[model samples]
Target: MAPKFFATRAHLLVCQGQSCQGRGSALLYKALWNHLERQSLAYYKKGGSLRLTESGCLGACSYGPTLCVYRPKPAGGGLEEAWYAAVDFPLATRIAGAAHEETPLPEEHRYGPE
Candidate 1:
């Protein structure tokens, strides 16, 4: 059977591979969940639109504590995807807020599409 999907505005997939975890991605993931809890957007079943998930490697192990965001594009134009690297706690909070508000991700400490 196919897995069911939720209608989430976006999902924050934090890298939890060996490299990212070594760089404290686990803490970053926890921090994001905390922020999501505060905003009441942590669970899709609870009528929330934001989701926090863990991923493996993401093929950018050099950039530990990395994360990716996937959301729908405008005009039903498929999906928009972006991967970010070198994410720390302070920046993680900013990202959480931006994702929750459907705003642009921060420009600093984020280098991707390579």
Candidate 2:
């Protein structure tokens, strides 16, 4: 049997594909890490955890430096996903802050299909 896993309220996936990396995803990722760390949400072992991951292409190469946030459903169902594009350090910091506070993503930054 597969190992059981604990559920987190939020997950943030930053795209590190060639295009995104070229467009400064690394800087965005670093900014995100710093923000989460400051908010005490950097690691699962720490209090107020948030799962952060670096992913492959999210199929939005034209919108390099893309990111996706997964928020768990309140009714014990699957997660709700949101995609953001053209992320920079400041926007990345805001995203991290949103995850820390369990708030919705910034509307202006959202991209991809509905």
Candidate 3:
């Protein structure tokens, strides 16, 4: 069984695929990290609870910069995953903040006590 996490509200997946990168996903990725650091949110990393991940194409090339957030649903409910398109730095931060309050961390983000 996968180890249990600290019960994060959400995990953010930023598209670093070729198309998204061309549209500025790299900068967006940095912006997301900076935002989390600035807020000192509880990420899976040493500092915060938000998990920032680099993902492949989400199949929204026309939209370019796209991100997907997986939020854990309440008991008896399914995963509440949302896909965002044409995301910029500011929007990513806002979305992440909100989602962080609603979802649980993905299995990939769960790390053992350090």
Candidate 4:
């Protein structure tokens, strides 16, 4: 059978690889969850659902505690992903707010396209 997938407007992929974990990815992940829950945008829910995933090694070990945000194409094409580096709790909260509000990410936090 084919794999099942859930539709969402945005997806946040937090790197939890060894390097990132050592650099505090776990705390970042927890902060993100708290922010999302406060915003009422839990993963795989109904309306305003934003998918949150823990990713392995995004290949920017030097920039540990990295996160990638993916927004689905409105015109039915491929997804758009952006990378953010050296993220902390505050930045994670802002990222969650951006995804919740359907707004662009803050310039400082974003690294570039991933």
Candidate 5:
């Protein structure tokens, strides 16, 4: 049996693959954490929490500095995924803020789905 997890509403996976790293994912990861902290989006926070993770390759090597956000829908509505490709510092901050409900997802940065 697996241990019970905390109340998490969403998860952000920042690719740390060699390619993505070379494009600045490491610095982006730190920036995301800091931005989330300033916005009170700690993973352990009560109610809806936004968790950040350093992920391995997401199989989009060409899209370096990529990220994916996983948000579970309510009432068995399944999961929601949003992929952002070729991210820069400004877009990364927007992505983090969206996870915390501070802003809407930037469609311009979105790489998958509508």
Candidate 6:
């Protein structure tokens, strides 16, 4: 079956691969869902705003626990996607908030190994 688009063309892909799981990716995924739900209720009010997709590893295993935000652009314009790595609870929250606001992902927050 085709995937549902809960909120236009924006999507938040959470990685739940083995490496990420060991690094507490599950907790991050839960936090993202909660944040998205709360934001959707407050804004959309009808429930179901941001679409959450649980994905496998997004490479960057060195970073582990990664997520990518897919933001579709206007007609004919290329879509914008950002991959975040080394993410924890706080980082995921921020990402979800940005996605909820339909804003671009911040550069400073892009994660990776030190």
Give the least accurate 10-residue stretch of model 1, judged by summed lDDT.
Answer: 39-48
What's the lDDT for residue 86 in model 1?
91
lDDT of 4: 0.81
Q: Which pairs of residues collide in model 6? A: none
Q: What local lDDT score does residue 102 receive in model 3, on the 0 to 100 scale? A: 55
Off by over 4 Å in 6: 1-9, 41-48, 74-76, 109-114
Best-fitting candidate, measured by TM-score? 2
Q: Please report, in order, the local distance difference test score of every candidate based on alpha carbons.
A: 0.80, 0.81, 0.74, 0.81, 0.81, 0.71
Question: How would you encode candidate 2's per-residue C-alpha lDDT over 28-93 as one tens digit per residue?
Answer: 887887777777787544676677899999999988799998887667687778899888877777
lDDT of 1 by residue, 4-101 (tens): 87777877899999999998999899888887787678755475778888988888888888988877775689976777889887887777667667
User: Candidate 1 overall Cα lDDT vs. reference?
Assistant: 0.80
Candidate 4 per-residue lDDT over residues 1-114, each given as its tens digit: 987776667889999999999999998898788777777787555555688989999988888899988886657798767888898888777776777677877666677873
lDDT of 3 by residue, 1-114 (tens): 988767566778899999999999999998888788878764755645677889999888778698888766778496677777788876787777676555333233222221
Q: What lDDT, from 0 to 1, does candidate 6 have? A: 0.71
* Candidates 1 and 6 compared by lDDT, better number: 1
TM-score of 1: 0.82
TM-score, cand. 6 vs. native: 0.77
By TM-score, is 5 or 6 better?
A: 5
Better model by TM-score: candidate 3 vs candidate 5 = 5
Q: How far does residue 84 in candidate 4 sit from its true spot (Å)?
A: 0.5
Model 5: which ten-residue window has the lowest total lDDT?
39-48
Name the TM-score of candidate 3. 0.77
